[model samples]
Target: MASSNYEVIRLKRDLPAQGVVIHQITDDRMKTGVPLHDALDRLLEAVKGKVLLVHYAKIERDFLEAATKRFYGKSLPFLMVDTMQIERRRLERTHQSIQSNQLRLAYLCQQYQLSK
Candidate 1:
Protein backbone atom coordinates (compact mmCIF):
# COMPACT_ATOMS: atom_id res chain seq x y z
CA MET A 1 0.00 0.00 0.00
CA ALA A 2 1.16 3.51 -0.69
CA SER A 3 2.29 5.44 2.35
CA SER A 4 0.00 8.27 3.45
CA ASN A 5 -0.71 10.23 6.59
CA TYR A 6 -4.15 9.45 8.04
CA GLU A 7 -5.86 11.00 11.07
CA VAL A 8 -8.38 8.60 12.50
CA ILE A 9 -10.67 9.97 15.22
CA ARG A 10 -12.12 7.06 17.14
CA LEU A 11 -14.86 7.33 19.73
CA LYS A 12 -14.28 5.80 23.14
CA ARG A 13 -13.87 2.05 22.98
CA ASP A 14 -16.50 1.53 25.66
CA LEU A 15 -19.13 3.58 23.82
CA PRO A 16 -22.06 1.71 22.41
CA ALA A 17 -21.73 3.64 19.18
CA GLN A 18 -18.11 3.12 18.38
CA GLY A 19 -16.96 4.70 15.14
CA VAL A 20 -14.02 6.24 13.38
CA VAL A 21 -14.18 9.47 11.48
CA ILE A 22 -11.64 10.22 8.79
CA HIS A 23 -11.38 13.92 8.27
CA GLN A 24 -11.90 15.22 4.77
CA ILE A 25 -9.03 16.67 2.79
CA THR A 26 -8.99 20.42 2.74
CA ASP A 27 -6.18 22.70 1.57
CA ASP A 28 -4.74 22.70 5.08
CA ARG A 29 -5.28 18.95 5.68
CA MET A 30 -4.06 17.72 2.30
CA LYS A 31 -0.92 16.27 3.83
CA THR A 32 -2.92 14.00 6.18
CA GLY A 33 -5.58 12.67 3.82
CA VAL A 34 -5.69 9.29 2.17
CA PRO A 35 -6.72 9.09 -1.48
CA LEU A 36 -10.21 7.90 -2.35
CA HIS A 37 -8.89 4.72 -3.98
CA ASP A 38 -7.01 3.76 -0.85
CA ALA A 39 -9.95 4.54 1.40
CA LEU A 40 -12.32 2.44 -0.72
CA ASP A 41 -9.85 -0.44 -0.88
CA ARG A 42 -9.62 -0.49 2.89
CA LEU A 43 -13.40 -0.30 3.28
CA LEU A 44 -13.91 -3.18 0.83
CA GLU A 45 -11.49 -5.35 2.73
CA ALA A 46 -13.05 -4.48 6.07
CA VAL A 47 -16.58 -5.34 4.92
CA LYS A 48 -15.68 -8.34 2.75
CA GLY A 49 -17.18 -10.98 5.06
CA LYS A 50 -19.66 -8.79 6.88
CA VAL A 51 -23.38 -8.27 6.42
CA LEU A 52 -24.09 -4.56 6.51
CA LEU A 53 -27.03 -3.63 8.73
CA VAL A 54 -28.24 -0.25 7.63
CA HIS A 55 -31.35 1.88 8.09
CA TYR A 56 -31.55 2.38 4.32
CA ALA A 57 -29.51 0.34 1.85
CA LYS A 58 -30.23 2.07 -1.43
CA ILE A 59 -28.18 5.16 -0.68
CA GLU A 60 -25.31 3.10 0.65
CA ARG A 61 -25.43 0.69 -2.27
CA ASP A 62 -25.56 3.44 -4.87
CA PHE A 63 -22.62 5.29 -3.38
CA LEU A 64 -20.54 2.13 -3.06
CA GLU A 65 -21.36 0.95 -6.55
CA ALA A 66 -20.25 4.26 -8.03
CA ALA A 67 -17.08 4.28 -5.97
CA THR A 68 -16.15 0.69 -6.83
CA LYS A 69 -16.75 1.24 -10.51
CA ARG A 70 -14.69 4.38 -10.55
CA PHE A 71 -11.81 2.94 -8.54
CA TYR A 72 -11.74 -0.79 -9.32
CA GLY A 73 -13.62 -0.92 -12.63
CA LYS A 74 -16.32 -3.17 -11.17
CA SER A 75 -19.49 -3.11 -9.11
CA LEU A 76 -19.62 -3.86 -5.41
CA PRO A 77 -21.43 -7.02 -4.39
CA PHE A 78 -22.30 -7.24 -0.72
CA LEU A 79 -25.09 -8.41 1.53
CA MET A 80 -27.16 -5.78 3.30
CA VAL A 81 -29.94 -5.94 5.87
CA ASP A 82 -32.08 -2.85 5.65
CA THR A 83 -34.08 -2.21 8.80
CA MET A 84 -36.58 -0.03 6.97
CA GLN A 85 -37.21 -2.74 4.37
CA ILE A 86 -37.54 -5.33 7.10
CA GLU A 87 -40.20 -3.28 8.86
CA ARG A 88 -42.02 -2.71 5.57
CA ARG A 89 -42.09 -6.41 4.81
CA ARG A 90 -43.25 -7.26 8.30
CA LEU A 91 -46.06 -4.73 8.11
CA GLU A 92 -47.14 -6.09 4.74
CA ARG A 93 -47.18 -9.64 6.06
CA THR A 94 -49.37 -8.61 8.98
CA HIS A 95 -51.63 -6.48 6.76
CA GLN A 96 -51.06 -3.50 9.00
CA SER A 97 -52.11 -0.01 8.04
CA ILE A 98 -48.96 1.76 7.05
CA GLN A 99 -48.44 5.40 7.81
CA SER A 100 -46.42 7.60 5.49
CA ASN A 101 -43.55 7.78 7.96
CA GLN A 102 -43.81 4.21 9.29
CA LEU A 103 -40.67 2.95 7.62
CA ARG A 104 -38.42 5.72 8.80
CA LEU A 105 -35.72 4.68 11.30
CA ALA A 106 -36.70 7.21 13.91
CA TYR A 107 -40.38 6.39 13.58
CA LEU A 108 -39.82 2.65 13.79
CA CYS A 109 -37.58 3.06 16.80
CA GLN A 110 -40.11 5.23 18.50
CA GLN A 111 -42.91 2.76 17.76
CA TYR A 112 -40.87 -0.05 19.29
CA GLN A 113 -39.79 2.07 22.28
CA LEU A 114 -36.16 1.71 21.31
CA SER A 115 -33.59 4.31 22.23
CA LYS A 116 -32.22 6.20 19.28
Candidate 2:
Protein backbone atom coordinates (compact mmCIF):
# COMPACT_ATOMS: atom_id res chain seq x y z
CA MET A 1 0.00 0.00 0.00
CA ALA A 2 1.09 3.57 -0.67
CA SER A 3 1.67 6.17 1.99
CA SER A 4 -1.03 8.74 2.63
CA ASN A 5 1.54 11.51 2.87
CA TYR A 6 2.71 11.48 -0.72
CA GLU A 7 0.31 12.82 -3.30
CA VAL A 8 2.19 11.41 -6.28
CA ILE A 9 4.84 8.83 -7.05
CA ARG A 10 7.35 8.54 -9.84
CA LEU A 11 9.09 5.22 -10.28
CA LYS A 12 12.08 4.58 -12.51
CA ARG A 13 13.21 1.19 -13.76
CA ASP A 14 16.43 -0.33 -14.91
CA LEU A 15 17.59 -3.97 -14.83
CA PRO A 16 16.08 -6.50 -12.45
CA ALA A 17 17.40 -5.60 -8.97
CA GLN A 18 18.86 -2.64 -10.73
CA GLY A 19 15.97 -0.23 -10.18
CA VAL A 20 12.23 0.08 -10.81
CA VAL A 21 9.68 2.73 -10.15
CA ILE A 22 5.90 3.23 -10.20
CA HIS A 23 4.75 6.78 -9.66
CA GLN A 24 1.34 8.39 -9.46
CA ILE A 25 -0.54 5.28 -8.40
CA THR A 26 -3.86 6.95 -7.87
CA ASP A 27 -7.08 5.30 -6.79
CA ASP A 28 -8.40 5.27 -10.32
CA ARG A 29 -5.41 3.25 -11.40
CA MET A 30 -6.14 0.69 -8.72
CA LYS A 31 -9.75 0.46 -9.82
CA THR A 32 -8.51 0.03 -13.36
CA GLY A 33 -6.72 -3.17 -12.24
CA VAL A 34 -3.37 -1.85 -11.03
CA PRO A 35 -3.84 -2.95 -7.50
CA LEU A 36 -1.40 -1.64 -4.92
CA HIS A 37 0.04 -5.08 -4.33
CA ASP A 38 0.54 -5.57 -8.06
CA ALA A 39 2.30 -2.22 -8.33
CA LEU A 40 4.60 -3.23 -5.46
CA ASP A 41 5.24 -6.59 -7.11
CA ARG A 42 6.43 -4.79 -10.19
CA LEU A 43 8.72 -2.63 -8.05
CA LEU A 44 10.20 -5.63 -6.22
CA GLU A 45 10.76 -7.55 -9.41
CA ALA A 46 12.39 -4.60 -11.10
CA VAL A 47 14.78 -3.80 -8.25
CA LYS A 48 16.29 -7.24 -7.94
CA GLY A 49 19.91 -6.10 -7.65
CA LYS A 50 19.64 -2.35 -7.43
CA VAL A 51 19.93 0.11 -4.60
CA LEU A 52 16.78 2.17 -4.10
CA LEU A 53 17.13 5.79 -3.04
CA VAL A 54 14.52 7.48 -0.90
CA HIS A 55 14.23 10.45 1.41
CA TYR A 56 13.60 8.19 4.37
CA ALA A 57 14.77 4.57 4.37
CA LYS A 58 12.88 3.21 7.33
CA ILE A 59 9.41 3.66 5.86
CA GLU A 60 10.24 1.84 2.65
CA ARG A 61 12.32 -0.81 4.38
CA ASP A 62 9.79 -1.67 7.07
CA PHE A 63 6.65 -1.27 4.98
CA LEU A 64 7.88 -2.98 1.83
CA GLU A 65 9.24 -5.97 3.75
CA ALA A 66 5.98 -6.39 5.60
CA ALA A 67 3.96 -5.98 2.46
CA THR A 68 6.10 -8.44 0.54
CA LYS A 69 5.66 -11.04 3.24
CA ARG A 70 1.91 -10.53 3.43
CA PHE A 71 1.36 -10.61 -0.32
CA TYR A 72 4.11 -12.91 -1.53
CA GLY A 73 4.74 -15.07 1.52
CA LYS A 74 8.39 -14.04 1.56
CA SER A 75 10.73 -11.09 2.01
CA LEU A 76 11.75 -8.39 -0.41
CA PRO A 77 15.39 -8.35 -1.43
CA PHE A 78 15.72 -4.62 -0.93
CA LEU A 79 18.86 -2.53 -0.97
CA MET A 80 18.10 1.03 0.04
CA VAL A 81 19.83 4.35 0.69
CA ASP A 82 18.25 6.75 3.10
CA THR A 83 19.49 10.27 2.43
CA MET A 84 18.00 11.49 5.69
CA GLN A 85 19.83 8.90 7.74
CA ILE A 86 23.06 9.66 5.97
CA GLU A 87 22.63 13.36 6.66
CA ARG A 88 21.81 12.66 10.27
CA ARG A 89 24.94 10.59 10.67
CA ARG A 90 27.03 13.26 9.04
CA LEU A 91 25.61 15.92 11.33
CA GLU A 92 26.21 13.76 14.39
CA ARG A 93 29.81 13.11 13.37
CA THR A 94 30.40 16.86 12.97
CA HIS A 95 28.76 17.58 16.32
CA GLN A 96 26.03 19.63 14.66
CA SER A 97 22.47 20.03 15.81
CA ILE A 98 19.75 18.11 13.99
CA GLN A 99 17.68 21.32 13.93
CA SER A 100 14.11 20.21 14.49
CA ASN A 101 13.01 18.30 11.36
CA GLN A 102 15.95 19.20 9.15
CA LEU A 103 16.28 15.57 8.18
CA ARG A 104 13.21 15.87 6.01
CA LEU A 105 13.94 15.77 2.28
CA ALA A 106 12.57 19.20 1.53
CA TYR A 107 14.34 20.82 4.42
CA LEU A 108 17.66 19.22 3.64
CA CYS A 109 17.35 20.16 0.01
CA GLN A 110 16.55 23.73 0.90
CA GLN A 111 19.36 23.90 3.39
CA TYR A 112 21.88 22.67 0.87
CA GLN A 113 20.18 24.40 -2.08
CA LEU A 114 19.54 21.14 -3.89
CA SER A 115 17.22 21.25 -6.86
CA LYS A 116 15.28 18.20 -5.74
> By lDDT, who's the top model here?
1
TM-score of each: 0.61, 0.65
- Model 2, range 1-116, lDDT digits (tens) per residue? 22222222222322233222233344443344544576786776666677787878878888788878988898767888789889989999999987887787778889889756
Q: Give per-residue lDDT, candidate 2, residue 33.
A: 51
Q: Candidate 2, overall lDDT? A: 0.67
Residue pairs clashing in model 1 are none
TM-score of 2: 0.65
Question: For each candidate, C-alpha RMSD in Å?
Answer: 10.2, 10.3
lDDT of each: 0.70, 0.67
lDDT of 1 at 112: 96
Candidate 1 TM-score, C-alpha based: 0.61
Tens digit of per-residue lDDT, candidate 1, span 30-104: 444566677777877777788877778998799789989987889979798899889989999999988999988
lDDT of 1: 0.70
